[model samples]
Target: MDSRSLPNSSKSSKSSRAEVSVKRSPVEPRVSTLLDVISISMGETG
Candidate 1:
């Protein structure tokens, strides 16, 4: 979300993309677990 606030100066475009990816790495495991849990919940609901 904050990424939208990034300067459109052009110079930051490449570097900001890399920063976003790096920031997402730590949440990968948690996101995976959440997806698995959601799948199981959907199966039960259906």
Candidate 2:
């Protein structure tokens, strides 16, 4: 589902806030993607 489907969003400020708004997850970010996990581990190892 798109973030626009959620509350508090209006089309007017979307161009500026879209990135920040879409990043707000109601749940914790998952480690579902292998690439994501790998990058995280690599960062930790640095």
Provide C-alpha RMSD values for all models, in order.
Answer: 7.6, 11.0
Query: Residue 10 of candidate 1: its Cα lDDT?
Result: 56
Residue pairs in collision within model 1: none
Query: Using Cα atoms with residue i matched to residue i, what is each candidate's TM-score against the true structure?
Result: 0.53, 0.31
Candidate 1, residue 9: the lDDT equals 47
Candidate 1, residues 1-46: lDDT per residue as tens digits?
4665665545578888889999999999999999999999999999
Candidate 1 displacement at residue 31 in angstroms? 1.2
Clashes of each: 0, 0
TM-score of 1: 0.53
For model 1, state the Cα shift of residue 44 in Å: 4.8
Which 10-residue span in candidate 1 carries the lowest summed lDDT?
1-10
